[model samples]
Target: MREKLQHVAGRVWLYPHDPDPEAIGACVGVIADDRGSVLIDAGNSPAHAREVQQAIAAEGLPAPRWLVYTHHHWDHTWGAAAWPDVEVVAHSSAVDLLTAEAERPWSHQYLRDQVALDPKLGPSFRARALAVPDFGELAIVLPHRTFDDALTLPTGVELRHVGGSHAPDSIVALDPGSSVLLVGDCYYPPPFHLRTDDDGPDLAMARRLLAEKHAVSVDAHSAPRSGS
Candidate 1:
């Protein structure tokens, strides 16, 4: 019900914390420039995506030049196809993971189960999803271009692959102009049930890198964290 877009610095904008009921997924970030804007992550549903799009336009910015995904989770990728025409960009494995999930029974069940489990989301998200009945329509638009490692935008935005905790395919976008690093679902607090493929070394390594980085860093669905 209550959604906020926080201007961390320069041109970086983050929505309410990713875990918020209204968000229903990770946080949303917007990176804008004179040429065009870039969406850090798509929301979880059509309604969610619409809100994100509206928020951007409300800011008087044009449609995003690219919709860069942090990972392939349903909360991040499901609403992608709902977005206005923009090139989707992601790690090759992210697209593969998206395609693979489309074929899984559990993927569809996540909706039904979440409604039964998460009280806040049930009324707003599940009820609406039930009204539609065609769960398959949520099929996302796949990334047109794939990259193995880092990809630099023509506009000079740099996205670096950062190891993740919630999922295997996490990456961070570096906006030099904004002096911000967007760590999408890459850092999670403790006592969490979500499991990651990474063991001790890689996850620890990622943490070290994040700590050493000097730019202000924000999680996929969080407020701006100080660079220190």
Candidate 2:
């Protein structure tokens, strides 16, 4: 079932609540107006992608015109293939990661672990997921537009690409009118695990970034927090 997060204005739908916490990472974003909507990050698989699509549809908003990848993690970018012909945007470094030749081995290993941990993923789904080409093979269709620092799309939404914090090309989105910020993976609450491969900025810096915006901030793993 899709879980909806309530906000004073607009709403956020979180995806995949299966037994395994990492099975399908959540996709976050808002729905408003008729021109279209914005999606923060795509989920882990095509199945998760469909769930996100359905969630967005249920919100009664137009199909997403712009989809932003908060980072280039396989869990975040793989489902992008299911999003159709939307204008996908990401940081320049994310684009590079998605287009790099060395991504497949790491991506395959990650997906394999996710599938193993969640038998709910099943064999057929695992096969299909494994078949999809890695980021380097599908970069052309994945993220067509890339930005360095900050870029604003239509509808008063601004996406600021902050240098590698959680990953090499992490980004955060801010809706000035709503004063809501969508940050993926950079600010997980408590019980923090220190993994060697985790790159980019630290949670403290992420907190500082949220503080600077003075917007209500939502981390990828938890509910929204007051930026103040």
Candidate 3:
């Protein structure tokens, strides 16, 4: 099912999905007063993006005005291309990775690995996965404005670039008034085989950081876990 969480103050809707048995990620939606909205972390494929779009339509929310990628990973950013003429935002390092991927030839082997890792997807999903061009041809639009440590959105949301734990340029968003923090993939549930040759969490650091907030903490995962 399409899991959801609501932020009343910001009118933000968080959609969570367990794409794999051990892994979960979320796509965020922020509704503007009467204007369009913004999306955070498009899912792993255009199909996922379309699913998000359909959900928004069902809810009568405004179409996403922008797409914000939490980090530079396939599961989070691969569906970005589905949005038309929308501004996409990500860290500089993320842009570098997306750019690099766009130029290389499509790798069927990599697609196979993705399928093997997430067997929940069907044959059509695999087709779209393998069809993605390298980063160069992927139309990876860079962030119009880049931030080093901290940045605030027009809606009075403050996002801070916490030091990299999951990837070289990961950032966390904190809503001081509401005490809600959006941490990307820094602290995934332990069940997933997180430790890998290249990417995973710095468990000790993540644990410490996770302790700071006494309020709700959201990740690109299934649900918002308590920070306390």
Candidate 4:
């Protein structure tokens, strides 16, 4: 239901902010270059994915020919099925995780597990999941394509493996063509939302280390465009 796109820098735009208020998903990124548009991360769910797909169409940009998964987090990876046509790209490690997760069907017990993960936020998350008409519905599509530590796409987007930030398979995409580096969830996520546990993605505290490391790496990666 929300229709908004943020042109952050150059042709770099953000369908920023998670449509689901309680979802851990972060803002989605889009890079519209001479080659074509590239989506940084998918939204939180099938519906969320469709919403962003429509939002991209509303922007008058060409459908994203490519999708780069910054990491394997659910909020970013689950919606990938929405764009079965795009050339999906992700880190090799992420490929393993995504493939493995697809075999596991989501159930109401998943909510109970979340509650067990964080006593503070668990009940609320469980309630939200229950509220969704089809919360138990689960599906995931592995990337038709993949990469190792780094890759360069035709759109002039540079994806370098910058894990040890959020997820071990995390990557920071540098788009000299767009003058924006799509770091995915590598940037600081909301502090309170950091729930690093045996079951969660990356530990929230680990993000600080990721930020520190990615800051140096991205700056080096963007020096020419930034004139630094």
Candidate 5:
């Protein structure tokens, strides 16, 4: 919960992830150009989103005109509602799951009930929810736009769906201007919520890496790795 936005390059700024296991949060990116600015992920809650906005504003950065999701996970998509003015975008496959979450009441009790019934909604997830100033203010905003394969923004950012074990609907955003690839959590193992030991996605990801021959692989939760 600190003002930690780091400039990656040209038009890319990264808000690094919070390392606390109990209330983890993923990295977020801001890519801006004359056409418009785009937010890579919405953060974990309304407060988290607000903090990002404030950080950008404090630095005199352009306010994001679009918010994109890498996948439909609480840590990534829960703060969508905070950026009401920006259009929310995600992969086509993420719509159903996100829409279902959007229908749920935004309250601590509701989340507690879900935790009791679903192992996937584990304690770590709940801890983050509790960290929110007002859990009732939590909201799941659905995507305003979606793409099956790729979408090229006016700013020259490319978003491509690259399904992986972490989340099938995972998408990576590449800022051509900066050569920064926002891979979200796709490179990581299934999160704590899923609690699985499946490495199938890892193998598939390796194959994808070989097929594309990417120069480097940047994970949302970890440092960049050499794709070579």
Candidate 6:
């Protein structure tokens, strides 16, 4: 799949999700500001993350000074090590989940074993993890800062925790200037790997926010849309 960044708003750019490849990573957002840009989520792997960095440079935007996680899902947080210089941020609930994942050993054999033993670790996930040449290099860097409810950055972006069935730590980043909301999978249905019948929650919070103040809503795994 071609890796490219799509401008969604005046100051918001999105690396959209491509479904051509199975187990592909989610969409990532870049909020550009004179103060210093902010990243929505790390890519699924180091290689994937590097693509984002390359795209940013190609567009002549400043490298992100901060990295924010929408949730603690592997696809969203695994590439964290790629941006070591940035101060990472996430919902307070994500720390423990990320810590647990970080404690686990990452290796081809371990991933295969998990897939065999745990229904949640399906084949697609294994394939995605294996895409990286060296599992030993995979790392999940925990957030350097966290918030329970909402926080605003100096760049004028707002981070808000709006937990839903998709994830208890689900959050969104709102760039008021652009009227764009970067909603991490907070509105997506549960993954098939989870093997749960529950589809998930509605995007009421996201809808309300957009309806109240924004013009565009960017989903982690879908193209940016207008009118909520």
Specify the highest-TM-score model's number.
6
lDDT of 5 by residue, 33-117 (tens): 6566899999888878888888787767887888989999888987887886898889999999888877867576777778888
Candidate 6 residue 122 Cα shift, in angstroms, is 1.2
lDDT for each residue of candidate 2 in 11-30, tens digit (9 for 90 to 100): 44344233345343555565
Q: lDDT ranking from best to worst? A: 6, 5, 1, 4, 2, 3
Number of clashes in every candidate structure?
3, 3, 9, 1, 0, 0
Score residue 72 of candidate 4 by CA lDDT.
82
C-alpha RMSD between model 1 and the true structure: 4.9
User: By summed lDDT, which 10 consecutive residues of candidate 1 come out lowest?
Assistant: 189-198
TM-scores, one per candidate = 0.78, 0.73, 0.72, 0.74, 0.87, 0.92
Which ranges of candidate 1 are over 4 A from the true structure? 18-23, 105-136, 189-206
Over 121-191, each residue of candidate 4 has an lDDT whose tens digit, in order, gives 56345534633347544467677777886788887888888676446787878767445666665643322
Instruction: List candidate 3 stretches off by more than 4 Å.
Output: 1-10, 22-26, 29-35, 107-141, 188-200
TM value for model 6: 0.92
Root-mean-square deviation per candidate: 4.9, 6.1, 5.3, 6.1, 2.5, 1.9
| Candidate 3 per-residue lDDT over residues 51-120, each given as its tens digit | 7777777777777766666676666776777777667766666767677766655455656676588764
lDDT of each: 0.69, 0.64, 0.61, 0.65, 0.78, 0.82
- In model 5, what are the clashing residue pairs, if there are any? none
Instruction: Output the number of the lDDT-best candidate.
Output: 6
Residue 78 in candidate 1, Cα distance off native in Å: 1.3
TM-score-best of 2 and 4: 4
Candidate 3: clashing pairs of residues = 25-220, 26-220, 101-134, 101-135, 102-134, 102-135, 102-136, 103-135, 103-136
Range of the 10 consecutive residues with the lowest summed lDDT in candidate 4: 215-224
